[model samples]
Target: MKKLVSMALALSLCLAMFAGCGGTPSSSSTVSSGPSSSSEDTSTSGFENKELNIAIFEGGYGPEYWEEIVDRFEETYGVTVNMQISPTIGDIIRPQIVAGNVPDFISMNDNDTTGLISSMIRENALLDITDVFEGPGLEDTSPLKEQVLEGVLNTAKCSPYSDGKVYLAPFNASPMGLVYNKTLFEENGWELPETWDEFFALGDKAKEKGIALFTYAGIHPGYMESLLWPAIASAAGIDTTTDISNYVEGSFSSPEVMEVLANIQKIAADGYLMEGTVALNHTQSQTDMMMNKALFIPNGNWMEGEMKDAPRADGFEFGMTTAPSLNAGDQRYVMTSVEQFSIPAGAKNPELAKEFLRFLYTEESVKLFAEKAGGIYALKNATEWSKDYVTEGVYSMNDVYNMGDSMVFGFAALPEGSKVTPRDEVFQSVADVMNGAMTPEQWAEKVEASFTEVSNMAK
Candidate 1:
């Protein structure tokens, strides 16, 4: 978990450096027209199969980027890419995976509700693609590992076993937090709150203007993790947050964490949460927030792209901020939402799949992704490199990294045959809390009990 601890500090440094460098890309600057396959000589040669099978999840970012990249990969290597891209890609691939007809590469995440990635983790069914990362980059002399943001590859998301080997490759690294309309705040002459006291005070002020302070995707309560993890880190400190991720016995029930939980409860109890928030799904909640029905929504940077075509209030513009701090000058934390890519343990063309993964980190692919999907890749300087391609709002979202510490939130992998998932134990109860069916103390106690179960399983 030292790697996990270092990730926050590493991101802080990356952001600081980015902030200090003020120069913009020149007008003549352009992404490479195509992927440079010269440096990929060793990895791409002599493919047993001239085809690479890929399954991608079409989430907030659409399939256009993947389609374009897959086409480029095919053209560069003279191969056919059989790609299955869908919002419910997990469902389409699950049966194939169960029958041992797994794809060469999968672009889904561990948190997908289909439990595909999590099941693979529990069964050790993912390919140990550590070499893919340790090998040289496709377009540069540096190792692929050196090209990515620091401390990201070592997390449980990538190295589920905590053994310094990466099974999952990093995809998009997005800053997750409170998303609001910058224009609305400016029009109202409202300042972003820096601490919880000011947060509640703002809630009161907004209430007078007929605006609720917060709203989240109620049906998918896990979305609240954008707010929850950062708030916990701000309240209890990063080490305590890591302790919670590791499922230490008292981490969830500790006094500081309980205070964070209580404040979350206060959002509901004090009527700071919007009406009908308990029934809204992600799109609905986001739409309402954009329409000014609620002042803020717990979400990530991709939200802007996802809702690009959706209706909004006059002068609507996306803005984001870290969770309110515990004290005026206390360091805040911005939880990072990292999607993943992995090869199944049983793949027809592991070598080719590895090559494709390497290609994805290339400057050409990174810029293409930013231009087509309006999202940044997980690689170092990706935002800065693609700033001209993405929208101004998406570019400004990177400022969250500069404003606060960046963190990735995931509990330690559960042992095989374990009956509980710590994430579900925590987030699933959020809807109940919002509805007054569960108290914050009860929420903490329930989560602690599940953690105890996981701890005992290790014994």
Candidate 2:
């Protein structure tokens, strides 16, 4: 929470909407409050009671935190709260959307595999929550806009499609990069690398000691993008980086992209990654790091909490740093991954849903979320109020901001009908390149073709 990145820096990046891949709807539950409300006040039944329905994506963090919050909201407003929760909430809610029975409020975690948010965004099924931000906070009269940290509300995550219209509200703030064992480095007297040369040199030394230089949550190749994108931005410059996200023609074939692919190739060709890593799940690869089978892993701050119960080498301490600069003196940019919230355009109680979202952004509610769920608000200049709830290993995220400027690669909505997403393609090619199935040139070419295809569709 110290040395937080300024909002000014956050606004400089090009933000875009992310489209979700469509899939069959999953199982779900519907809890309703005995019915009736076409108005904000009393229902047609002439009852003074208000009712609201919310659906939450149940991820590793679970839904208890939100259930408690809903309890408080219900207590305060004397309303009946209906809850629909599931790990597959996105898939579960898709059919509901089709049936014209959308929940009043919803939170689809960033890790949702079903891509529900993206699908909804692509269909323009989400309400533009711009007015919610401009309105007052639930706890106070000040405009919610003023209460937000600078740049937090301006990013692509909030205004997907870059139309200056906010459909998603920022939820959790996560800094991602290279996570390693500090104790291993200290015990071996290896200084953290700050440049590519130093990084490779250390990798070589690590390899000699029977430790692979790098590994990732291979099952989730998407995670490795965090590690690779910053390196690309640092070497290529921000303009080229922006072009990549915007699907600019020939962006993938740029010299900067080639550099990124080449570096990745070098790692693969050099035999630097852990053996059999391309098949590992997130936790399995993370376990490799915990057990010292691999020296480092590309992960977010959540790794610490996610791996808290796993075994670790004695004196092991989690430490995170930005990817080494492309060369000495290059500007390093750390990536921040954010979780988001939104209301459906068809939400029956849009007013109540907006009020609930505003409450979530309030100082007290934010603190409660951090305390109960170990989540920090995405607001800039936010502090570590939930420090006690967070494990020490995750605290390494703080070191990243203190070290340099930070930027997030905002999720871009791929043009609909594209067979594959640029990210999915990048990840697939990365696997092929790492495994020697594709040459760096081939990878670059594939990516370029995908970029051109998406660009053409956008036109």
Q: Highest TM-score: which candidate? A: 1
lDDT for model 1: 0.82
- For all candidates in order, the CA lDDT equals 0.82, 0.71
Most accurate candidate by lDDT: 1
How far residue 89's Cα lies from its native spot in candidate 1, in Å, is 1.1
Q: Write the per-residue lDDT of candidate 2 for residues 1-459, one digit (tens) a residue.
A: 012112232223213222221111111311222211212232222322667778776654545467666766665556677776655567666766777878888887765567778777767778999988787765555777776656667766677688887888888777888888998999889988888788889999998789988899777788886778788888887677677777776776777668767877877689888898889988889988888888879888767655666788898898988877777888887887777888988999888787678656655555556555555677643455555455555565667877656776765667776665666667767778888889877877777788888878878
lDDT of 2: 0.71
Residue 350 in candidate 1 has what lDDT?
A: 88
RMSD of 2: 9.9
- Tens-place lDDT per residue, model 1, 118-144, is 888888989999887787886777788
Residue pairs whose backbone atoms clash in candidate 1: none
TM match of model 2 to true structure: 0.85
